[model samples]
Target: MSAALRPFDVAAIRAEFPILQQQLEGKPLVYLDNAATTQKPMAVIQAITDYYSQCNANVHRGAHQLADEATRRFELSRDKVASFIQAYDRCEVIWTSGTTEAINIVANGIAQRLKPGDEVLVTEMEHHANLVTWQQACLRSGASLKIVPIHDNGALDTEAFAALLSANTRLVALPHVSNALGTVNPIQDLTRLAKAHGALVLIDGAQGIAHGGVNVREIGCDFYAFSGHKVFGPTGVGVLWGKAEVLQDWPVWQTGGEMIAQVTYHSATWGELPNRLEAGTPNIAGVIGLAAAIDWLTQFDVSAIQAHERALLAYATTLATDFEGIQLVGTAADKIGVFSFVLQGSHPADVGFLLDKQGIAIRTGSHCAQPLMQRLGLPGTARASFSVYNTLEEVDALFRALKKTQRMLA
Candidate 1:
């Protein structure tokens, strides 16, 4: 189906998340820490409950009715994920513990192929999940880890990225959206440039998938990785989508049951495409819940969700600009619902604590992008990230709490 935007019903949407009805510290809870992880909708929670209640069994191993049912549901989630990302083939989708493990799987496989002095490129805006794995891979192979700089405006320096790419560049790891800055990188353009230099590209879609759906074929990247928890799904479940041709030759990273074709005393043969990568007992219930989340999300037009989030971010940004001693950290022309900022003469942790007293939940500190923090020359920033269920009223409440926090600190 073609993607289109529809009018959003915020109240109805908010009702789907049960956690939103609660209170914190005797005040109504105002959740704005979505960039860390989104609250699960009832649909997702119920799916998990149903799995544990009705069909809890080890998948793909038994002939019992419950095992058959469990296996069926587990594989069904893979099909749903493949469709969600518009992957070329369903077999291209490999399940992992989350984005961190997903990236590690690729890095482990790529480690076998890297050579001394080979260049692995990454942007400065990457989260630790994407950056650390590549650093380890380069270190193991005696390869060089090259960095692409970000502009002062929180956008990637595309010109610097272009200049950095060369025949020696083996892989380019980047994020679809900056988790800390909320800057949306031009993935398609970046992928094309990397591919032109004969480098494979891996996009960390942990933030991007929640904002809107992704189409891997259109982006032209070799691999895409995302976490389920970031998109209103259960934690400990994520996807790694790769081109079949490329994955076919990649060496297996993990070993054990469900990933071997033949076992012997001395050596064993690995299974095909996805099975080769996914080893041992999987997160069956989490995968099922993730599918439910994706199913619920598809009921609404993704473009509509994106627009709503953008509106919330713009509203928050405007309000922050008017506040005294407030400095917005990332002001990229393109961004999502993440508002990272710092107040003069106040520590980020103190601000977070003060906000929490009023039942406002926001993230503080480096947000796992310490390298990006070092580049920006700040200890940390207080972050308020929005989602589809967030409202203008919540944004207003956030500012009110911030005002109170500023006064207390002053």
Candidate 2:
């Protein structure tokens, strides 16, 4: 935690988000759908509004005063993003639509280099964004895709993961945290092992970015990708952070204006590291709002926020354990934010529907992880993910609603 910040206050934090004050079906809102997307705070909303009201001009191409201001803010936000993840160089932080597009950018380059007998390693807990991207990359390149097994407790099998890294492995893609199960992987050690084998590692950071401090240098991964909407920012914006050396020569994901340096009727040349990958007019307001979101989030102490989240998860776990007919899924010791479970003799969708009637917002079904659901031998689970703004009272409300849901289903 930063020395300047005081004790964590859930009430003070909750007041910053206007959306949380509303009601559904005459019940106060208890939002637990954070794994899907987070609600924006007033700081982020004001930043977007200020951008459109003051400087509504294209970046880097306009010569007018509004253009200059717009370009300055746009580039400054890029610097803010570079600092947020502790990235070594600003050029390595390429803007993308979200984690999905970021992963595809890397996959596009790797697929061109892969050949038969090469392997790409991934885990059984991947969101479809990371899993299907590599799957298709391997299919297109004739490389074998190897799946690392997870234990019944939802933790990654470290022994199997190390064994799978062989001379044939060219890339290792894994999620920093499992979106479906809320299982946090040991990414630092995993990245070290992958580096030892000379294979590139990409961490899908959609779930991990909002939980705690993430230092790219300390993790030693070549690439990390995350979405802004998952961290109190605007939608349609994300960041893909890569090693400067690795990204300098990465094949461009798209080709258009802003990405080109020189062009002829027959051929053209690409721009530098960041712009080379980011083609056309970018998501201007989204990027500015994302930068504001991170700035607001960092004012609080990271350790304090993490401790509060851990407490929420611990209390929720205790309540779930004693609740009859409720079976908790993803009981990994290291997880913090998500609580996924199923009701005995009831479908997950039915549980979610009943909970919604009480103004408890949660996610149901595969969570973009059908393979993980199949691995656990279930249809799907109802997931309730916590954020820093959520209160202990909200967690209790979720359980109370679940009790009501159970009785109604019976």
Candidate 3:
């Protein structure tokens, strides 16, 4: 937490998002599906509107005044993103559609370098975005895929991870925080262990960045990926931060006008660090809006927000435990604001449907983690994910809704 930051005020924060004030089914909306995407604050929304209304132009290609202003704001957003994650060089941050595309960019680049018998390591708890990309990469290159196991408590098995690394391990990809279970992985330790074996590390930070500070240098991972929508920014924008030297040598997977330096009818040379990987026009307004979101977040102490969320999770957990037949999933000692659980003799989708009648929104189904669900021996769990703007009253409302749902089902 910064000393200069103002103390967090939940009420004030809630007021900044107009969408939260809406009514659903004649009841106030209680949005708990934050893991899927966070609602944008007015600052972020206005940033997008202002971009199109005031300075609508393509970046880095036109010589007009609007183009110049648009380009300046777009690149400034890049600088803000670089600073947000504490990257060593601003040029190391490459824009992508989201975490999914960012992971694919690295996976594809690494696939070109992979040889037969080289191993790509992942974990049993990874989101499909992190897991499937490496799986496909391994298939393309004839390299084997290795998985580190997780304990019954939803925590990564450190002993198992240590044993998996070896001379043939070329890369180790894992999530900083599990989206389904909310387990905060020991990324620093994992990165050190993998690096000791000369394996490149990529940290999927989609859930981690939303919780609090993330310093890539301290973690010492080769690459970090996250999405803007998960971090109070606009959708269709994301960032991939890599070591400058590592990205410099990475093969370009996308090619078009912006990525090229010199081109003829025969062949072409690629551009520098960031642009080489980012081909064609990007989501210009979304990038600007993401910078606004970052700027808005800087006003409050992130530590305060994290503490509030921890309290909410604890409160919600206690309430759920008292409810008959409500079984909590992911009991890791360290977790974030996610609460995943199952109701005995009830389907997760049915529970979600009942909650929706009370104007409560949550996520159900596999959560893009079917393998994780299979590992836990369940179909899926209804997930209620919290954010900075949520309140304790809302937490209580969730349980009340659950009680009503339980009686109706009975």
Candidate lDDT (C-alpha), each? 0.93, 0.94, 0.93
TM agreement with the true structure for every prediction: 0.98, 0.99, 0.99
Model 3: per-residue Cα lDDT over 298-346, one tens digit each: 7877778789999999999989767889999998999997999998888
**Candidate 1 per-residue C-alpha lDDT over 252-326 given as tens digits, one digit per residue, 9 for 90 to 100:** 978999999999999999999889998999999999999999988887887788898999999998897789899
Q: Summing lDDT over every window of 10 consecutive residues in candidate 3, give the lowest-scoring window.
A: 1-10
Worst 10 residues of 2 by lDDT: 1-10
Q: Against the hidden true structure, what lDDT does model 1 obtain?
A: 0.93
Off by over 4 Å in 2: 1-3
Q: Ten residues in a row with the worst lDDT in model 1?
A: 1-10
lDDT of 3: 0.93
Residue-pair clashes per candidate, as listed?
0, 0, 0
Report residue 2 deviation for candidate 1 (angstroms): 8.1
RMSD of each: 1.4, 0.8, 0.9
Candidate 2 lDDT at 197 equals 96
Tell me how candidate 2 scores on lDDT. Answer: 0.94
1-410 in candidate 2: lDDT tens per residue?
Answer: 45776557888889989999999989999999999999999999999999999999999999799999989998999999999899999999999999999999999999999999999999999999999999999999899999999999999999999999999999999999999999999999999999999999999999999986999999999999999999999999999999999999999999999999999999999999899999999999999999999888888888888898889999999898899998888999899789999999999999999999999999999999999999999999999999999888999999999999999999
